[model samples]
Every structure is written in C-alpha cells, then in structure tokens.
Target: MATSRIRERSPKRDSLDDLELPEDYVPYVPLAKRRAQKYQKLIHKKAGLDFGSNYEDGSGSGYDSNDNYRRKNKDQNDSGRDADEDDDEDKQPLTGPQAGISLIEQSVELRKAQLSAEEQKTDVQKAMEEEAKILAAVAERKQLASAEEISKGIVYKDPIKTTWTPPRHIRAMSEEELAATRLKYHIDADGEDMPPVIKAFRDMKFPKPVLDYLKNKGIKMPTPIQMQGLPVALSGRDMIGIAFTGSGKTLSFTLPLVMRALEEETKMPLAKGEGPIGMIVCPSRELARQTYEGFVGIADMLHKGGFAQLKVLLCMGGINMQEQASVFHGGLHIVVATPGRLQDMLNKKKFNLDLCTYMCMDEADRMLDMGFEEEVRTILSYFKHQRQTILYSATMPKKIQDFARSALVKPVTVNVGRAGAANLDVIQEVEYVKQEAKIVYLLECLQKTPPPVLIFAENKNDVDDIQEYLLLKGVETVAIHGSKTQEEREYAINAFKSYQKDVLVATDVASKGLDFAEIHHVILFDMPKEIEDYVHRIGRTGRSGKTGIATTFINMNSSEQILLDLKHLLKEAKQKVPPVLEALEDPMEKYREMGAAGGCGYCGGLGHRVTECPKLEQQQKTKNSGMSRPSERAGNEM
Candidate 1:
C-alpha cells in the first residue's frame, strides 16, 4: 500500500501539449567548477610612494573635508594627547616594520644557494666515486700482481695417469659384508641368483672387448641394479625393472640392450623404414640424449675385435625434424628418442619398427603420467610381436601394470627398495608452512646448504617468481620449465651443472631426465599434485650413493594426504619423520579412543545413536519451556 501511494503521488506526463520546446533561445551550458583555491591577499605598495606615510593619521587645514570631521573629535581627545608626544610623532613620520626585499631577488638568492649545495653534493659524490674506483683499481692491481707472482712461481703438471690396482691384498666381502651391502642398497631380487654377483666383469664372461671397455670406464663391479637386472633383461625375456632414480637404472637397461644388440647380426644398409636394431624411448630430451650417449660410448668400446660400430640416433623435436628424420633415413644401429617425437615420426611413416628387435622405455611411469600412453601404444602397434620389450620405471602404477600385461610376455618384476620410493641416500624432510611463508622458508633452506640447489615449484610461473625473488634477495638463480625454449632450458641446466649457477628453480620438467652430480639439496617449494611427482622431484638429489638433503614446504591443510602418505613412505624407508606429520596421522583414532559407542549417523551427533541422541538435550529444554508457556490454556480447557 505504501509503494502504491508513492507511485500514485509521483508525477506522470498525461499530454504532450504542456511540454516545453525551444523556440528562439540558445541553451546555455554550465561551466565546469574551478579547482584552483583562493589564497590570502598579498599587500602591494604603490610605486614611488612611501610605505610609512600610507598608514599615517595627519593634521590638515580647515579647508580639507577630512580635517573638518577630525576637528569635532580632536578637542574631546585633547586631554589625553601630550604636546611633546604630538611633536615627536609629527617629526617621526610613523615608522613601522622594515619590509623585506623583492621576492625575485630572494628567489634568485635561494636558487643560487640550492645550486651551490647541489654542486657541492655532486662534487663530493663524484670525488667519492673516483676514490672508490681508484681504491678498487689499486686493490685489483695488487691482486693481479700477486696473481702474476704466484703464476710465475707455479709449475704446470700433466694430468696424473693412474693405473688400476686390483685389491689383490684385499679380500672379498664376507657373508656379513655382503648382507650389509645388500641391506644398504635394499636390493630385492627374485631370480635363482644365477649370473651370481661377480667381483670382476671378466668373471661375467662378457666379450673380451666389452670387458676391456668396462675396465677402461672404471667399472670394476656392477651396481646392485646392474647386478640383479642384467640377468633378467639379458635372458631374452620381457622384464620390469623398478629402481630408484640415478641408482644406475640407465646402465641396467643400456648394458642389456647393448649386449643383445651385439649378439644379433648387423643388417647392412638397414631398410628405408627399418632403423636401429634397438630403440630406447625416454620421457624427455635430456634423458634421450643421455641414453644415446651411453649407447654410443658402449658401441665405441665394442667396435674393436670384429664387433661392428653402433650408430645411434637421438630423436627429439626441439631441433630440426629434418635432422632427426635424416638419421632414420640412413642406417642406424640404435635409436634413442622421446615418446612424443617418436610417435610423430611413426605417424609420418618416417621409420619402421619391424627391425627394432630390442625396445626399452626408460622412465615409463613418467612417460605415461605425461599423457603419452596413447602415443606409446601407437608406437608399439608398429612393432612385431617377436621383439623383446622391457619397461623401466621408478614407480609402477595400475596403468603401468595394465600396459605391461598387454605389452610384455610373462615378465620378471625386479624391484629395488619400494616402487615410488625415493633414494635411501636422500634425507627427506618436510615442514608444515603457510603459502605466504614458503619463499622465506625456501630462502632459509637454501642458506642451510651450499651452492647447486635444485628447487622444485608446482608450475612455470611459480618457478620464475621464486627465481626472481631470490635474485632480488642477492642470490643468483636460474630456472627451467617447459615454457622456456630448448636452448634456454639447456643453458639453465648446463649452468646449474657447471656450478656457474648456484641455485636452480624449476618445474617438474627437470625432475626426471637431467641429473646433476653435485646437487647437494632438493627443495620442493610447493607440494606436487601427485604422490609420484613427489618421488621424482626429490629424487634429483642423493644420487649414486652420495648422501643429499631434500626439503619440502607443505601447508598443513593442503598437504594432509601428501604428508600422511609421505610419512608412511618415509617411515617405511627408515627416514626421519617430522612431528607435524606424526600429529596429523589418523585423526579418526582420537574419536575411537573417546569410547563413543555408535555415534549418530543421521545428524552426525556424537556419543549416542540417532534414536536416543544426547544432542537432543537443547531441544528438550525448548520443549519443556513451550509446555510451561501453555499452562494457562490447559487450565482454561480443564
């Protein structure tokens, strides 16, 4: 009703006859409001006039109108005026305060003072700069002279050529020693211990040339993975080798592939589609290149004594595709390639897989995690069923299992430590930190270690942001991610590897493939999305038996499951678990310990079932109060 009244009171035009129209006048537009403020009035003196005389009350002749008006009041104030004062005042001409000089003159003087100060400041600054430069130059000259003097006294020596001294005097490890070694590596083997752990490569009965190559490369004995996995991979059977990263997983697959390739006869002028005899697929270009180099080195060693030289081709898409295709165009013994690039080539019909008798997928879990399973499947379609297939991954998930079922024949599953477990040598530590405090915590962690730190972020933007922030904090940093060009990524990796860059911030792109020998620490700036990624990111450090540290920044709320899983993983691996993780593990146990029986499920009430829920206590009070309020009505009805 109020809204209707308001609407009824509002004016509405009923006819056009009363509307006003412009007839003969121009409409005037309002001017914009001025923003300038009015200031105090500045008194100005009239030129050629005395400033003192302008304010004086002077006696005048009777003919003057002003003198006539003053005559009436002059007699009334005559008693207060003195003859001496009037004489002195008339003679003094009413002098007041002396006025300041013209503003132009004052401004000019102030500007001159400022200019003088500025010039002095500049001179002092310039002198200081020159003095600093001279001092620096003098110090540098002294350093150079000292360096020259040292250089003059220094003697250059050739690199020491040391001969291998077999420990003839030393005895082989006893049973205790062997057991400790196995436990240290957490070696899990399933075979009959055939091709038993030999102390020397010659004992393995490898080709004499292959033994020579191993001897020259300083491989006196094989790593545990190489020792266990070699037998299964070499027996002409499909295999799944699960090992920690950088635990010689590369060599485990490469050595067997090389051995198999050497046993097979080399086909001269490999057919147009048929390329290398063995094809190794990696998830990233770096891994592919490393695998290619390994094959090349082994082939170089085997070339002597009737063994044919192996020509390995690296197939990755960063470089010219024509160059990659050119390698396939010609005959090659081995092909190392990333899965995506290899699939692209296969789709183009640039290569054939019929002759690829030996196939190995390094970092198979990583390859599938990157959504390349379809491409891997497509590549496998071209392969003949008779070829040997070996899948090597750090972790084996259900997808990998399914893939293995379809791809391999009854394969031997070899596991070192637990699958998806970090290196035992790496000390994993996690801190429950807020998102805002991550960078500060990361900085603190960086300070805890020496140079060559591998810091992992969740994405490319975070990597760049952390790197830039570290740079601003007076630390030199480099970053790598998928968004960067191949050249930039290589440069960053190389810089970090060469120790030219002390700190490296990156996404998971650098997680699996590139291995830095001296990386003393790995920091997860943010928790990875998947548990498998956490394994890979921190696996960068503590490689090859060298102990390293890995610190992960996790939020208590966001990283509950991750921390719980990590706690279990670390606990299983015999690592130190933090108290925060200990406290967060199994919150449901607290409810069980309270002795609550059959907690209500319908309304989520505690301590009792929904039928006799103690949570109804407040409703009972409301019901009693309602009943009390109706006593008078009940009395009236009675």
Candidate 2:
C-alpha cells in the first residue's frame, strides 16, 4: 500500500484547466468579477452616463474613463447629508423652481427631505416630535365640527352646559354634610369639582312623572350607586360609575339618558329620521331588549305627562334588520342597541348619531370582555360632536380604565364600593361535588331554595343538558343561549319572568345585566373560569337590596387559582369558605408576607400577580399571534 501511494503525486489542479470540458461549455466568470460588472452597469444607469465600448466588451473600465461623470457626481451621494444640515438652520421649503416641479417630483423630494431629517434626530427628539404631532391632530379634530353635527345644526363652538340644578333642600346642605352623606354611603368620588352625592330621589330634581314612576315601581329610596352616580350623570359630566351589580346602575344612567332626550325633544320636535338624542350601547341582545323596554316604559310615562311620545327602538342581532330600519324612519328619540348590530346599522346607513349627544355604555366591563372594544370605538366615531359619555359597570379593571381614559375627557369616577367586590346581600354557599355527580347533586341543591331559580353553566351544551335533565325530572325549566332564535329567547325570558317556568338555565349571556325579579336562588353548576364571572353570576339574586342565596359547586377539575379567588371572595364578604379551599396553599403567601403588592392590579383577581394574570397573558398572546377572531365566550348574544 505504501508503494502504491508513493507511485505518483500530481501537483494540485488550478481552476478547471486540468479537467476535460464539453466543447460547447462557456468559461465561468469569477464571482467577484460578475458582481463588479453588475455594479458598474447600475452606477452608469443612475448617473446617466453611457456604457463605453470597454464595458460592452465586459472589462467594466468605462466608469473610470468618464471624467465628466466623475466631476458631476462627486457630491451626489452626500446631497441628503448637506440638505439635512441646511434644514437644521432653515426649516422653510424650497421655492421658485422647486415649487414649479411636477407633483410626483415634488412628493419624492419632500419624502427624501423627511427621511433625511428623521435620520438626524435622536430618540428623545423623535418622541417629542411625534407627541407634538398627535396633540396637534387632536386640537384640529376638536376645533372642526363633524359633518353630522353641522347637518344637525349643532355648533361646535358652543360649550356643553350643566343644566341640572340640585333642589333647594339639597343646595342648602353644608359641604361637611355633603361629605358625610358620601361617607355614609361608602361613596368615593374623584375628579375635578366632583358633584355631591344625592341623598334621595327628590334631590335629583327628576320630573314629576319620573318621580311618580319611581314611586309606583316601589323605588322609595336611592341605592348607593344612584346616590353618587345620579348626580354625576345628571350634571352632564362624562362619568365612570363602578358599583356592585344590582346597585341601581341601570337607573342611574337610564333616567339621566331619558331626561336628556326629553329635554332635547322639548327644545325641537323630532322630525322623521332626525332624533335619537340619547344612545345606549349594550353588550348582549337580551340586555339591549330589556333596556329598550325600560326606555319604552319611561317614554310612556313622559307621553302621559303631556310630552311628545319618545319613540324608542331596539337595535340588536336576531331581529329583522329591515324591521329595525323601518322604525328609524319614524324618528327615534332613544336607541338601545348591542354593539355589533348598532355598528352594522351605522355601516348600512340605516341610522346616524348626528343628534346623539348622550351616550351610555351599560355593563361597560362586559362589553370590553366580549371583544366589542373596537366595535364600540367605531360606533363612537359615528358621533358628530362631543358626547356626555357614561360608563357603568360592576367592575373597573385596568382595561376598562384605559378604555375610559381614551373615550372620556375630564370624566368623574364614582365608586360605590371597591371595584369587583361581590354583593354583601348575597349569602354564598360553596359545595364540593365530583364532576360526574354534578347533575345528580344539582337537583338536590335546587331544594335548598324555592321556585324562580336561576342556574348558570359555563357552556352552551351544559345549559341545554341541564335544562333537559330538569325537564325529564318533572321540573318546569326554560333555557336560553346564543343558539336560540330571537323569538325563542324572548319567549323563554318572558316565560321565566312571569313564573311560567320555575327554573332558567343559561350561559354567561344571561349572567350580565339581566334583571330577574324575585330570583330566590342562583346556582352555578360548575365553577366559572374567572372570578369576575362568579361575582356576576351570583349577582342574579340579591338584587335591589333583597337578600338571596348563591350556591357554587367545585370539584377537582376546577382551577386552583379560581378556587383561591373564590375562597378570598367568601372571606371578604364574610361568607363561609369550604375546608377544601382552605387547605390549598396560596402561591402568593410568601410575597404577601414580604409586603409585596397583593393580587393582580390589572384585573383585581386575588389569585395571581399582575404578571401572571390569565386575561392579560391571553391578550398578549393574541396580540403577538395576530389573531383577529372574536372570542367565542362572548356567546350568541351578539
């Protein structure tokens, strides 16, 4: 083998000269030479220099021989730098010949100048400039009247007036007395020149008809939310009202909205297709319909009091779009609509918000939770002039606050209790039941309370299954979900409300903003994924100061975080916490002992830190993944 290796050692071959090649094969050019040729051609084309014979022959020597090209293009590469330096001294645009240039050429030059100027700026300078641009845009928008406002004869220059005056007795109260009233009601008001809390319905200066309606409805006293929220809303100030559910939040905004509409109608009779001075945006169709009915009742009262009939329309999905559109032609004084259907109508030119200056977002937190934030913004854009916006919610999470900051200007914040706190009027009961045994245990739990019970499940399928199981067991039951037709949902709701059905099984769609009368019991078939939902679910009972009971079933499948939150909520409300929940370790125990901030500031959920908030994390993931699909959890109530 050694002798064979030493036989012959040929010199290393150079290039392809040592190999036999095909006769038709063209010699390969070196990569550097090929790149040089391409660059030479590009330079010649940009400089408007002709490619001489040398370049045509593939030598690429034409660029060096052109003395005139070199002389003319010597400083062309530095032109942008020179222009940027000149701009630092003088910010004026070029005039004379430059001004006479074609639009295309001028645009190019302007873009170039902008790019050059931007390149020379530091990060701080760029930030300042961007902020200045945004402020200027906002100022410009504020100064200009929208086309809709102009068409409605609204002048942008006129300032919004606070026409609601407190009654003589209320005005006679000293400042200390007013503060004491707020303190007594646990009312916390924050803003510049906050309105004083109203002590009674009489202090709100409601029209006699409204006062009579309240008396007839047996609303003899103002709830805590009404005590503070009514004054803030009636004062024509944008407001964020946070109070526990069933704290009269609906009346706080609805009464003011109706009053404002009545005032506008008195000033100028509504012509066909020319009204809706007040608009209320709700998250679910059921809530929208309920609100519409409430509006109609108030409108009837106003008509009976010798005022023009206030035409109210319910705009929501499932109803015939044509039917809703037909009502718009008769002139609507107030509209209660779900965000999706309202935006659809506005997009179809079925209606406009030109005259709508009073806007209320009921269950504002739920609207945001249902992925209607963008749709809400789109609806707001349709408003022609500044509106007095009122956002009412049982919870004021950071997301809602951020939305408020963007939507309202100089808004007063009214909180009747700590945001997201459960209702003390509800007697909470927690039970441990295996997942497979939940159905059997559900019937047993129903015996704890009487008829007119509300049962909440987390999913639509569960709702249907529960309803069927109850019906099979000889229990009168009704069900509603997003899958139900509009007529079916309405009938089910009315039947339940009228006591035709002893039990109502539903998803989260019915959990929010639906006021059921005399609901003696609320049962959660399974623990909710979020603690906020649990609060709203139990809120079905214990409405309007009536004490009620809420029973929740939890098993191994329930998340520890949710269990921890449930435990804390029970403790906060002085309800009994189950031993199963008490035995679970708190992940934040050490952090709390270290005096670190407790719970999530973003959502007020006691189970997790802000960084570990599931809602926030899911939102971030959705944003990062560029997801555009609406959440299915919003249910069929859209």
Q: State the C-alpha lDDT per candidate.
A: 0.62, 0.77
Give candidate 2 regions above 4 Å deviation.
1-159, 324-326, 628-634
- How high is each candidate's TM-score? 0.60, 0.74
Assess the local accuracy of residue 368 in candidate 2 as a C-alpha lDDT between 0 and 100: 70
For candidate 1, the C-alpha RMSD (Å) to the true structure equals 34.7
TM-score of 1: 0.60
lDDT of 2 by residue, 88-148 (tens): 4233333233433468998898999999998997654554455445434322222122344
Model 1 is weakest, by summed lDDT over 10 consecutive residues, at 33-42
Deviation from truth (RMSD, Å), model 2: 18.1
The C-alpha RMSD of each candidate to the native structure, in angstroms, is: 34.7, 18.1
